[model samples]
Target: MSNAKSYIQTVALRDVKCYAFHGYYPEEQLTGIYFLVDVEVTFVHTGDTENLNHTVNYEVLNTILLEEMANSQKMLETVVRRILDRVLDTYSFLQTGKVGIRKLSPAMPGEVGHSFVELSYVAPK
Candidate 1:
């Protein structure tokens, strides 16, 4: 067997559906929209992986997303940035991460699947 100094692990919360009134257009604000949020974070692994403290909790991520989404904004970029900031702030052990928000059936002329924005985080050296 080979000895290793440390391991890196990534935890993700995917396809989280949320309904919020976030849009630049007035009509979109009135009608509201469905969004799918995906969050993932990479961190240095600890020996006590079984312990909740040693790893990122999915519930915490969900809570952050919901809380941020509750506050309506004209742009998804703002929401995504807020989510990423919260995640990084919540866990000091986090190394890198990404937060993505997708607006389903966006209010546009042509048939569009979704409009998406993603923000990433990297811990300072």
Candidate 2:
């Protein structure tokens, strides 16, 4: 257990996809868009990170992500910020975390793969 990076656990939800009406263009709201999110939190478990009480629940995070993504927002940055705020606030014990959001199919003239917005946070020392 000594060399296994024993204490720290990285709780993550990867490439969670959802449909939403969020963009800079008007048609984007009417037709909607695809949003992909990835969230990760690194922390030293107080008791056990695998346990329900000691760790952040995936369902709760999914709910938060869906609720935030449902609203018609103008920017991916706003979406990412709100998700991070809610998660970090709810799980105050987390030492550090990151939130990544991508507009999988942004409306554009040229062929654009995706628009990415990411936010990272570390609790004050």
TM-score of 1: 0.94
Q: For each predicted model, how many residue pairs clash, with residues at least 3 apart or on different chains?
A: 0, 0
Candidate 2 runs further than 4 Å off: 1-6, 47-50
- How high is each candidate's TM-score? 0.94, 0.88
Q: In candidate 2, residue 18 scores what lDDT?
A: 90
lDDT of 1 by residue, 14-116 (tens): 9999999999987877889999999999999887878998899999999999999999998889999999999988998899999999999986799999999
Candidate lDDT (C-alpha), each: 0.92, 0.86
User: Which 10 consecutive residues of model 2 have the lowest summed lDDT?
Assistant: 1-10
35-68: candidate 2 lDDT, tens digit per residue: 8899898878665545698878878888888888
**Candidate 1: residue 84 Cα off by (Å):** 0.6
Residue 94 displacement (Å), model 2: 0.9
